[model samples]
Target: MNIRNDQYTIILLLLFFPSLGISQVEFFGYMETEYDWMEVKESTYAFGYNKLRLDYESFPAEEVSIRGNINFQTYHGQTIWEAFDFLPFDSLNINGEAVHSMPISFLDSIYMDNLYINAAFPRFDVTLGRQPISLGTGYAWNPLDIFNQKELVDPTYEQPGVHAVRLEYYINEKCIVDFILSPDTNFTQPSGMIQVKSNVASFDYSVNVARKNHLYPFWEDEDTVSTHRETSFIGGSFTGEISEYGMWGEALWSLSSNNSAGDVSYGLDHTFNNGLYVMLEGYHNSLGAEKDGLYDFHYLNYFSGETKSLMQNYLFSLLSKQINEYVSCSVFIFGNLDDNSFMYAPQLSWEILQDVSLSAFTAFSSGDADSEFGIQNQSFRVRMRAYF
Candidate 1:
């Protein structure tokens, strides 16, 4: 079908059948605007964007429900040096300039971020359509999540949805199982996973096995190419609390026909009586580099979306406190132990009104030029958001 036809069909369905067996409906969303300034070496940059989202949920029946979200965004920016150091290219051009820039105009897209439906039964539930799926216990690194991969630096951000069908079954009061099927290329080559979760004593745990497809860097003699490959993954995670401290751990092993890799991550967090909160996390990837001075053009092209860092070992720490009823402050540090590079980000937020907030943040890096967090020198951001 054509794109225009698909859009028309969706709009018709939304407008013509507003009360198709629906018992209740709810609507909500948010609007946000942000401005950023960045300094990389001798170059300075500016960026700004505004985003609007609309979300709706409806209960069609006692056993059925529907949910969806639509997003609209407009942005304008110019960058003299690249804002992201890990991207495949150096700088992007917009209008005959060696800088990243987007004019202030509406994007030519009415994005449907999520559209899904669910049906529940006594012992099992079924979900179908484009939806978000994530599975893991670790806060910083989620090695066990096979679908909807997340960026560790901004773990709380919302992820895009994927088309899939999922089935969940309850075995008993303490155990449950899930099965997911996601199709690729006309539903012939399907990928999926099986997960079993249980509560043992005071800890909650899950084990998963899956078959998935990914893109990898392939070398043929002197030439390099990005090739598609299939892999099998096995992983598990556990979360528990000891006294006032919370702890979580996750591990994953990936096996291909020719190579195998693994990763592990763990975290600990605590909240004091005075409302001070702190967290620490550690991560290790067997497929990552063990030494410094390894990132180059080829490395950037191969690992842009696959990994966050080239180093094998990493540590993350966060400290946050609520100064008053309307203000809060936080600091986060990310360290690459193998290269001795670190990034520090500090932020302050104020609740301007009941449904509005303002925030300011700054990020700085310390390391040599060749190290991971050193390419992008510093950046600052100010954002305002209103929830409706």
Candidate 2:
């Protein structure tokens, strides 16, 4: 066996063998199948993925516990077409003879190699190895995460970063403060930071500030250097239930030594007596007059791509109803006041068996600039899932 596999097996045995004399070991996991298709304005593609996760949590002491999670994925067919031809190839030739060979890129191999480890103690947690960092009101941009994942909602959002150490101190039942520290390494620079979060009856808030000690090269443009680019983000959100309806609103402002941006968003979700539910959401990035610096709204960072300009106004709505105990249907539509790019989604789901389900999802997009999966979005997918 390989070194890593040997280590994993050892850890698994240690976790269960020690509990044999006292208690039984606990096992947990989930399975999911997701199929997605993209029909852009000028192009289209289809892909699907399945994954499984196994984990164990054991307690040797009342206040102390060790937990581990291992996950893997099985991918189906994949393909991509380039708009312009760059690599010319008649055939794989060896010594001037034709031969068959497959081409691959960094991304093509990443799905097969994803692993992580996290251990927690009283009021503290430390995660070592590769992982993903997701936090804050900025759904698309996570300034607080140094090891930010390239895709906002990418199921494989896990990225390589330094060992993350975090601590939480409870001030009371409604408030708690936490801090996270991670040292820069080969993949990232030495970085450290802290944040404080509070919760009230119907409101939640957080303040985060951090520093990336060294001037780093910008990811969007490798040649450009982001020197002494001290950055800070302030964000908060409020959510409450009113007369059987759910409502929430959030705002985020990003401030850096060289740029500033703001965002305001609100949403309402309600369920009817007939087992039907509806949701309404709206957002305004800025006045649209102009800002001192660029504000990106893509899944990743602004540098990666231009932010979606909703023409100062954008609204989205969704309706869903349960057809029966084992089936359901839903539709989602989002548009702007100016008829810019729009989006539509129709979905159907069915329960295959206990703890297992299957679903189909389709989408269409058109208009002015919207989110990344803009107005030119369309796709179909089938999925199966199980949990324990």
Per-model C-alpha RMSD = 4.8, 7.9
Worst ten-residue run, lDDT, model 2?
105-114
Query: For residues 275-333, could you state the per-residue lDDT of candidate 1 as single tens digits?
Result: 99999999987656667435443354324545434668989899999999999999989
User: What residue pairs are clashing in model 2?
Assistant: 184-189, 184-190, 340-367, 340-368, 341-366, 341-367, 341-368, 365-375, 366-375
| lDDT of each candidate versus the true structure | 0.75, 0.54
User: Best-fitting candidate, measured by lDDT?
Assistant: 1
Scored by lDDT, model 2 comes in at 0.54
RMSD of 2: 7.9
Compute the lDDT of residue 233 as modeled in candidate 1. 78
The regions of model 1 sitting more than 4 angstroms off are 1-24, 79-108, 185-188, 215-226, 256-258, 293-298, 301-304
How many residue pairs clash in model 2?
9
**Which window of 10 residues has the lowest lDDT sum in candidate 1?**
100-109
TM-score of candidate 1 against the unseen true structure: 0.84
